[model samples]
Target: MNSIGLLIEFNDGRVKEANFGMATAARGENRNLVALVADGPAEDAQAVLEAYGVARIVNIRSGNRSWDPARQAAAVAAAMQKLEIDSLIGLTSPSGRELLPRIAARLGAPLIMDCIDIDLEAHRVRTSQYSGKTIATIALTGSHFIYGMRANVVPALKEPAEAEIIDFSFDGYQDTGYEVIETRTDGSGAHYLAEADIIISGGRGLKRAENFKLLFDCARHMNASVGASRVAVDNGWVPYAMQVGQTGVKVNPKVYMAVGISGSVQHFAGMKTARMIIAINTDENAAIMANCDYFAVGDLFEILPELEKALAAAKRSKEVA
Candidate 1:
């Protein structure tokens, strides 16, 4: 049996739902699964990790509550060595994108990021390559391997298991000589596009930057993240961080809504894994119309307002009921 470790990501003291998917992918009948949390609430993490097949949770208490990449990497490496973990898996989300490589470098392990599929025994991975034009199968050969799986593709199936927290401070972990003084975002927290359950993306159809308010208004009712196509970002309609395509960020949300998008190959490659896709476009011949699960042909300006109001009414009615 392989000693497998899962990096637990938390937001606001709550376990991110995406971590469950990672756990599910790492667990099997012959695997030993453990959760490694760094500077987060171990008790809260254990509660969720335990429900999803984790055998134990290790809390890396660095005592300093600052964002230290090097120190965090050392702590995780220490745990990996002490626990005899041959492989570690995490999400391809923001933190995973940043932390996994650091840990891999520290541990001298081969790192694979944004992998679509994994086979632990063979140490093989299937990941997108050539800007989503090809799916490459990689065979890793090293003392250890770290994989970052894209969110949502792996189902978060629960198989109840025992969870116990172990407090671990690395034997010899030093600071990375840097600290985060301040962090600023676009005010959307825990609603990242790549990690969102539902994403509403706008394209050239938005017409103006201010028109995003319509999408935002709808998103407020649905609690969804906003995404944009390359054209929208090129036109300065939205920031690059919100771009969703092969050249941008890959997503695997449960439901993806494409508004005013023509469904370019790059854009489709990014969200093709989405379970459900809804498209709203005026052009009947738009590629999105054919590829989407549901298509609505109409003027977005007219359809969006009615959709938003109807959603609001539905939410209110549900709450009242």
Candidate 2:
């Protein structure tokens, strides 16, 4: 079997150096895998990697004050060469966008980005593209192929595995000649929405920012995340982070609850992958009803609070059980 290396994202904005444990778990097989932990301490990151079934880990320290994509890429390429990796897998985050291309260029390998799924067959690998709207089954013409996995698409798995941590240091790389003078991280907690199992979203009929609290309360009761339509964001009723549309964040949760949303095409683009969609609106002819797995025709203000109370009572009953 070919070796697969997974590049992980550390909380410190560096790549976590470790093997692809989730892939191993999903496949029920083990391969030569190496993880690269960038920027953060390897020991802390190793715990998460170990849970995923990584066999070995390679920790790389760039010794730079800020995250330099080029430098990180150089480190990853060096590790890949040392490990003799047959394929490389990375998260399709902002850093991956910059690093994967550089690593592919340095290694002279085919790069596939934003892969939603992958299949390993006899002597070949396959993957999907274009937000899963299109499928491109690829046959690796070369010995090595690099893939960037879309975040939240692949289910992360945990399996106990012995992980050996190795430290590596790098030097003598071309400086991209760029400096990050100031860095400020967005404190919005909306990132959880991307990985959420369930999402509850609101639209223009939500009326005002204060009304959004109902959505949030319902979401909390269900242990779900809150989202909003682009119209709500544009109207200043919600933050841009909560917006779900073509211009906003894309989500593929197991269940989606859309409240008072008219279901514009742009809004549907962001959440159409939801396994089940439930829509609530006063107008029975609202566009959302047509696409919903379930629909309720009524005033949102009346329905939302009742739903919240019902869910809350259910939670309390479960706890008492």
Candidate 3:
């Protein structure tokens, strides 16, 4: 069997539980190993890896909340070399993108990033490209395949096992001279677009920035995060953080409510993975309506308030119950 290694992150210890889901897909016909990169939440990392049936857990300590990607890359590359790993899987966060490439380069391996699906047949691993919009499956010809997995795309599995913890230290690991000058957490406790369960998006039809309060009201009622089309974000109706599309964040929310969006293909690139989509727009022929699970054909200016009232009433009744 091939051996696969997972580079783990412990953020507030909450994400340690997430590793089991990630490891499960790679474990069939593969020996699973997890390396816990200690920044925060180390204990959580140990628990998650053990639950995932990891054969070994390597722990490395770093004191900084903002970890250096290059250092992480070097550490992972060294571990891969030492263990003779056949395949390596990392999470597709900003840090993962930065680290995995360098690690792949060090190992002389082929690197695939943001892979939504993977097929391991014999010695070949096949992957789809262009974020699932356009399909091109390629098989790896190299001895080792390195990849970054999109969060929640793979089903996590749980197996009972005792995780063997091992400590590993990197000596003379030079800092890449990049220091985090400042840091501020979002405090919302919501994950980014790629990880959100529900997304409420606005678009060009919203007309003005001040009108976006209506969008926010609807999102609050639905208990969802806010997102925007590129046009809306460029128009300054919403913050750049809320933008969703090719130029913005990619989201796979369970329910995506798009208000006033015309849905350009670039915008669709970001949200096409949503489980259920609802569009509110006057244009029945809008591209968004075509892909939506349900569409309300009407002027959003007239429809938003009614929806907000109905959602509010439902919330009130639930609270009463």
lDDT of 1: 0.88
For each candidate, give its TM-score against the true structure.
0.94, 0.82, 0.86
Candidate 3 per-residue lDDT over residues 1-321, each given as its tens digit: 566777776555566434555687777754656654544454556665677777777665443446666666777677666667768777776567687888888778887776666665443434334644775555666877887777677667788667777665656467778766776767866446666677888999999999888977977877778889999989988788888988788776778989999988888888887889999999999998888899999999999999889999999999999
Write model 2 residue lDDT over 1-321, tens digit each, in one string: 546777767644433322232354234354655666655577776666776766677777765747777788888887778778767777655577788998888888888765555554433434434433546766555666777765556555567677899887777577778666676767754545555678999998899999999998888878899999988999999888788767777777889999989998788877887889999998888889998899999999999999999999999999999
Q: How accurate is candidate 2 locally (lDDT)?
A: 0.74
Ranking by TM-score: 1, 3, 2
Give the candidate number with the greatest TM-score: 1
Q: Evaluated with lDDT, which candidate comes out highest?
A: 1
Candidates in order have lDDT scores of 0.88, 0.74, 0.74
Model 1, span 1-321: residue lDDT tens:
777999889887899989898888898768989899988889877767889989888888755677776678778888898888989998888889878998899889998998989999999999888777789999999999999998877888998999877889865865557777777766756378898998999999999899988999999998899999999999998889889998788888889999999999989988887899999999989988998899999999999999899989999999999
Better TM-score candidate (1, 2): 1
Q: List clash counts for every candidate, in order.
A: 0, 10, 1
